[model samples]
Target chain A: MAMVDVVVLVAGDGVNRAIPAMLLLLVVLLAGLLGGRLVALGVALVAAIGFAVLLPPIGSPRVEPAEDVAALVLFVAVAAIAGVLLSTIVLSDRRRLSAEQGTVEALLRVDHDRAALLRSVSHDLRTPLATIRAAATDLQGFDHDPAARTHLLDLVIDESERLDRIVGNLLSLSRIEAGALLPERQPVDLAELVAACAARLERATSKLTVEVRAAEGLPLVKVDYSQIDQVVANLLENAARHAPPGSVVVVDVERVGESVRLRVTDQGPGFDPSVRGRLFEPFASATGSGSSGIGLAICKAVVDAHGGTIAADDAPDGGARITVEVPIDG
Target chain B: MAEADVVLIDDDASLASVLAVGFESRGYDLRIAATGGEGLREIERREPDVVILDLGLPDIDGIDVCRHLRQRTTSPIIVLSADGAEDRKVRALDEGADDYLTKPFSMPELLARVRVAVRHRRALAAVAHDEVLSVGDLAVDTAAHEVALAGRPVELTPKEYALLMLLVRNVGKVLTHRAILDQVWGPDQPLDTLRTHVSHLRRKLGGGAGAPQLVTAPGVGYRLLAPGDVVS
Candidate 1:
């Protein structure tokens, strides 16, 4: 006979008293599964006493002390065994549940991040595309004067360039994430690199004043020329976007110990305090506008690949200053 | 001088047609080639005044085309490339391309580059032997190795003088940063050095009223305004 049935039969009146003892054993097992051994033992002791008192007289009018003692002992033994067995099963099941929940939460987080990325990409790309379309439509519509036509063409060109920048940033960020950006290093004169970057930027736009200052006889650092150029260019462009009109963007380069230090300072409102820590994180833009928001991130990746460090902080004069230091080879 | 002929080498049909229309409106003859092979053949056949080459080509590599063209003729080659392709752009300039325009460039900007290229070609052909080249009040005496603004002698360092002389010689022509670096500071010199000298030259030349302004082409190069050229 099954253990429960055997216990039920021992009480003699199987219908009323034995069934009650069986129910009490089930409750004790559940308490052990949820609350451990101490709880299960306490419950079992209380139920045993209750069952002994409440059970109806099992046989003829005379109650045998030995038989009654045996019945109570059987009830307590079965309850304790059931409680111990269920506890292991319950604990393992709980562990499996938590593990599954962790995986589910991770998947949800990835989905959320992907959604945010798509939203940001679409918003950044659409603005420039819309401008280009509008400008093209205007160019085709009427017999405008040469100057007016040129103005519309300028708009189209500028907007397209903006779109190109966004696309470039996206590709660069993806390449970086995929671990494909292995910089091909060469001995590069940091002063010349900064000047070339400044000159290129100056040629693109005439508004901001880009002043370059480098210590004479700065040491040449080994770096990928093109990648370092992109870094400087990104910083200058960021400064140009944030700095007030007619403000100066200063690019300073110097030799610090065994490393080359380059700093780009812009006379702007300074780093946004709220997003300061995450400034170099992908998609963590301070403007929260049409910017690709990966400029600083790219700089950081390129710098890190070169065994260098980059940091952003507020300048003493209340402007954004970004500093990059790369060790120079002997 | 006869009307200048321009050859554009690019695979993008839409952009070519648009550029052709723009150039035609500006009174230049425009011929479009769909591939680098066709472009070289066209250049060889027509010997156009200026060649506008696209860096990304369907057949031969753009830089190779530039190197090959440099061997064949001295006609100015203006490269068209996408933005952020600075390395390739620099390589093209090194390969003897006179100037370059980043893609999505305005028609006016392209025209400006063309004008600079054509002017540079003419300047090369003419090869002025005059002792003093005058632009407004700025005079550069090649023989004396001196510069004077408004008849007053301006003392300049050798590097600054060399930079000024280059701009004066190529007045109204945009000299690429690499080109300036090559001519003034030799090859592999840093661009910042060029900028420092240029800034000092600009200040000494007087960018104030009635002075010949040292105009910047931003990302391309610098040009010294000719006496008759408008400041804008």
Candidate 2:
């Protein structure tokens, strides 16, 4: 302030003099924001004293001094600077509030999703339990034909398997969420993994057969064997649950570029475009038919843990297709 | 597989009860012991043909019981365990349990495993070292040290022959890598080399329908499937 005042005094005081003084106010405002109002007040007082020492006395009469005009210009500049600084504070405060509101909105969305997942899981678990209870309860009376009794027993077994799948998926998802499960890595053959998964799921899937067309001599993808099996099994399970009875679920595996790409195509109802966006979310079953609902979520988590990518889309021949790609050495 | 005597050690009465019903229908006499000590005493007294031990015994650690039982009896010890720990299962198998069934296993599946274990023990008891052993169309003539698949003699290297003979002797059983390595390569070989050898053998044994399959049990072991046998 003293430097600018001396310069203005030597060069004839003008409107430009107030511009430098305005910069001093901006510095004070910035200091106010950084160090609180006390520091700002101290800086402002020093600036005012500097101005007093540098400027002409109030009673001094020079040869046609334009002190009134310069004082008016300085006052206006100070008011404009103060106005902008105060608006900046208010604007920043508003931005912070909106940001916090965004966080709250996100949290609400997550809470709603959690509630939906719980409902879906409860429904899924209870459906199989209800089936098992009804079948076993009927079988206990021992009044039905042998074939009927066998069918009831089969239902109990099937429902129990379903329950097992749901429980397994929930455990896997929780482990993933807790970051407790570190995949034990191995050099695994993808074809073998698919075959093992198909064999395991064959009993549970009543009609749909997991037909694999794996390219021979696939590079041994370094991954966690059991984890990858879970991923493939979940995909096949989802396919079997959705595909029409007696339809073939085609599992295609091949080395695509640097990654091994696995695609499971089901002749079921294709993914509705609306739900495709959240298809990987837990409990987002393509068809709401008693699916454990965490299948895709498991697939996503396992594949992600392996540094791989998973995707879903409508098949060209009127079905849904889930594709997964894992690096050979990942 | 006549009506074999069995001793089951499980704290869960529900499993014991269910297995009792299952064994009765399957023509086996089951002796239940709720604790590991009782199980060992039963084994000492009766010397059953098969022992089903649940590793989650209330009184003792299942693995220690497994070790003790392995030292006490020649009967096959088929372990019952909860899932999700390959290490525990491997340790059990390494502790001399012939086979294992994960918990919540279906009745039929458990029965199948029991049958396999009994049959395995019988095979072990009745082994004549010089006799010919076969699974599906693949046969190993111990007399001549020759391996043949589908009437076609498939020449194998020493390691390959040893591996094939080991698998043939224990047909329909999942042999852990360590088990195979300990017997074939004397417990000193890397697992990756074993995998490579298996893949080579699998490629050599590749055929059309009815070919014997060296079915892979991921992260655990391999099972040789008879030509027409379906995977469990």
Among all candidates shown, the one with the greatest lDDT: 1
lDDT of 1 at A77: 76
Which stretches in model 1 have alpha-carbon errors above 4 Å? A1-7, A11-14, A54-70, A203-205, B1-232
Overall lDDT per candidate, in order of appearance: 0.76, 0.74
Q: Residue B221 error for model 2, in Å?
A: 1.5
Report the C-alpha lDDT of model 1 over B25-136, residue by residue, as the tens digit.
5578999997788998998897888999987674688899999988887888988764335677777877878777665555555776787677657765675777887777
Clashing pairs in 2: none
lDDT of 1 by residue, A137-190 (tens): 445644556875776577567667767767877887888979998888899999
lDDT tens digits, residue span A31-57, model 2: 666655456656666655444344456
Superposition error at B133 for model 2 (Å): 2.3
Specify the highest-TM-score model's number: 1
RMSD of each: 28.9, 24.2
Task: TM-score for candidate 2, please give it.
Answer: 0.43
